[model samples]
Target: MKRRDAYLKLTRHNGRAGTHGTYNPKHNDRSFNLANSEHIDPERAKGNIYWDCFYGFRSALAPQDPDDLAATFSEVERQFYESRYSNFVESQNERNAKIRHTERNRSIPDLLSSRKTCPEETIYQLGTLDEHASGEVLLAVVTEFIEEFKARFGDHVHVLDWALHLDESTPHIHERHVFDCENKHGEVAPQQEKALEALGFELPDPGKPLSRRNNRKITFDTACRKMLFEIAKRHGLELEEEAEYGNREYLEKQDFILAKQKEQLAAQQNKLDELTLKVNDMETLIDEVSAAAYDKAVEVVTDVVRTETRKEDMRMIEDTKKWVLSPERKAPQSTREYTAKHLDSVLGQVPQDHADHRCPLAGEAPEAGSPAERQGADQGKSTGFCSATAEPLAGRADPTKAICAAYRRKIRKLFSIIVRGDVY
Candidate 1:
């Protein structure tokens, strides 16, 4: 196996780009870019790791989305104000004509940038692209390192989030935390030196006063780096601790260049994603509008067809009724012949009113001098008899009324068939 170098870089956040979007990505939107399909391989995203232990320190008023370092710092500042600085603020307001703003009236992020506070960030890797450790082994070692760090510094340092990015060329971890300790007012405030001191970290050179190269922070980082190497050893990982001269700066410069490139690419991808979302939304809206319009058109057509069909049917029924009842008009010869044959049966089946106790043909005055009229006159009978039955017609109503009713029924049946598309 190739021997890998154990790497850890501690940082305090500046105004530069951050790692939150790259850590937890909502890929469907533009919330994240570098961690999306454009820069990070989508197929490999499943192997990425995210572990967040910031819930214990998250404020109730914090944003619901993924935590950023700014929000984390704000929470720390809020804790200091609520627990330690509130009383002092109240007393100052009561005593002075010029009231002091709440919680020192300062921004935590500004103080952090100025080095008045510390926001701890560390990126750990066990290998380089050319000679990297196996992902399984690296993960195991990093897991142990995280547990050890938390156990050692839980009292003063709080872990916000940690992400292991496997989609990149090599596996590595980005962990963030904030160091805090009680101040003179007995209120816990974010202060890196006091917290490291509380954790028993001493200056690198005991004989010298605290300075940039001999600070407790340097001592703390050295101890953490040593712990990481020890954990890797237990996991059977061979890592080099000593760095060659000038190698550290070169690697850092390379890392910085790569980061800026990714940021530019991310910016481009974000614009593309926004445009895609707008196009998709417009497509969905058009489809809905088209469907609604189509349904309304169908409804209007159906209503118009139904109204016109009812009117036409009524006109046809009225015309047929007039022809059958008219003494001067007659049906076609074929229709008359068929009707003549079925007339008796049709007459018997039609509904009758018992109150009309008269001849079936009595209601219709036949053409003068017709056979039925002559027969009635010759027989000296006031009522007409059916020509089909040749018997005295009583209690049966008008034949014309029955014939029109039967014709109306047939016409309605035919209209129903036409409406159902069974007939043209």
Candidate 2:
């Protein structure tokens, strides 16, 4: 549920300084009259003026009884001036360098830096009574309300000037004060904590660390509302209290947002850590995947080579069978003649116009006049893969034996690499 709005408003202004720079009673007086619409005072113009004092029952927030208001203002104003606090205030200001100590004191040095004597003053409306009512109704209610407040409040707080202002947008009492800022034993109290307890009101818990700081302001604002509420009850007024203290709600919401932001930051950090761990293992993961792929590649290449080798071996065997099964073996000729016949068979399979597409093999190339080159073959010319022997099987009728041996040697060399797991 939404909280009801506040009807009473207590405000403060330090009387130490005026709009120009320093404290000036004339400046305060002008402001007071302007606020209360007393510059063209209606009652004073009629010559049937009700009172001759700064304040009276007639000068209340809503003066219903002129006699009573005049009397109250007279009594309070008389007591205020009789306090004889001006000498103390003037001397104190001089000592603090706020003003010159004497008319002819040019040679004297200041004891302290200039400062206004009173630092703060306070004021507020009694309740919402001014909103719904005017004149005597407001005056009567406010008078009773102030009486209750004074009876319950501290004595160290001295009222200097007071007036009920009906000329404002809403009626409120303007009160000036000099907080007797020292404790009972004559030592200064921080933020007037001990001084405010002059009536034996409950002392604030010292355990609250901020009692001297922010809580000091909050505590007083709370106390003002409490006092008004209690008094408004006796007057049958319907003032309500707002739930929020000035700026308190905004500050609390900011704290909550800040806490959530911190949590999100922590969560993001955790996610980053997990990602970092994964990145650290990336090299190992890569090696594992690479090893599996290499094994599969070796298996595929070996199977393909073996299948081609089998077909080549069968053809070579068929060619050699013609030579070994022939009756010409019983009348074998010289090795050179047999080699020449063997070369013819192999050359027949090669295109006659493609002689320049030379077959190259391993080892040094034969010299121009050597037997290998003479038969249209060379060595040490790269074929992109491992070199094979291409030694003049041309013009040799027994080419089958040499071709078969070459095939076996190449197959064996490839198989050994794959079997030993060294292909990669």
Candidate 3:
């Protein structure tokens, strides 16, 4: 027998109606026959007859079985009694199927994924009992909630969709929010509290009056952006506008500093180039002077050699040779020859009557004075030669003295020429 049939039999033996004794064709339990009870004594089956009569009357009135009733009529009794369990199961199955279909078509998972990654807040207004409340008032309440949510969730909460479904008699808004659960740590509420604190507002107790709280009201349109701003402010997040301005200022300052540095570097390089050019010019001049001196030295040496080989003035030539080769000589041979030739060249350039030749010992024209004149007089008495206009012969015992004196005079003249800018 089916479980329902067995249940029906047990209820009948206990003198009770199966499903309140109402007949239903769709019911799994077998219907009881009222005529079968007539074969038994009424006195011996009074309890069965009483229950049958009651069920017979109820079936005639209602015309539906209690066990096979629809959900609305059956749920209360079926919930506790477990008599209408199959019907409940069928209803639950229908509900689950509908939910599954809706979820699949809507692509809830994909929507959730998108919301998780998006960095924006979702806002919505909650319905209250007040029907006459302004839209602004509704928005203000929602804005407060948004601020609280931001403080609690920090960067974790992202609002995806928000809509005020005001067509209903009791207007309310739907909101979709996403949390970056993997990135955020700890409880969300505490973080929200911190955010509110930063905004100079304390978390309000739900029971508190709106006027007592620091609640500012706003309309739906006004509330959207304001809610975002409040949330971002509480969490110390930067808005696109502020960040862009900051970046621009930073770049301008950096550019100014770079331009100044470049200018300074260019100036320094210019100065260095100028100094280098001056140094190069000075070095070139020094090299030219040195080479000229070397050539003049070679010329003087050649002249001395020629004079000695020709034997025109053996005594003076021999003395010159001795001076050139002497160990006691302070100057090198090259230096000595260079000085003699240089002096000869300068003397050759000067006129013969130039005062440089007046005294054999005089290196230059003697300063016009008493002491030099007396010295010249004494020298003249010893040498028996006039102090002025008297050229010493090459064969003299001390020919070098005359040459050296002439060389000194020539040097003084050359220095004077250089200082006077005549050499250029």
Sorted by TM-score, highest first, which candidate order results?
Answer: 1, 2, 3
Q: Give a tens-digit lDDT track for model 2, residues 93-116.
A: 565574554552321011111232
Better of 2 and 3 by lDDT: 2
Taking all chains together, each candidate's TM-score versus the true structure is 0.43, 0.36, 0.17
Clash number by candidate, in order: 0, 20, 7
Output the lDDT of residue 107, model 3.
27
What TM-score does model 1 achieve against the real structure?
A: 0.43
Per-residue CA lDDT of model 1 for 240-309, tens digit only, reads 5454333543344446668778999999999999999999999999989977975665455444433333
Candidate number achieving the greatest TM-score relative to the actual structure? 1
lDDT of 2: 0.42
lDDT of each: 0.53, 0.42, 0.36
lDDT per residue for candidate 3 within 141-227, as digits (tens), equals 554664565565445444332333333343333343333322122322212223333434433344554442323211222344555
Q: How close to the true structure is residue 334 of candidate 3, measured as C-alpha lDDT?
A: 72
- Point out the worst 10-residue segment of candidate 2 by lDDT: 106-115
Output the lDDT of residue 134, model 2: 44
Say which candidate scores most in lDDT.
1
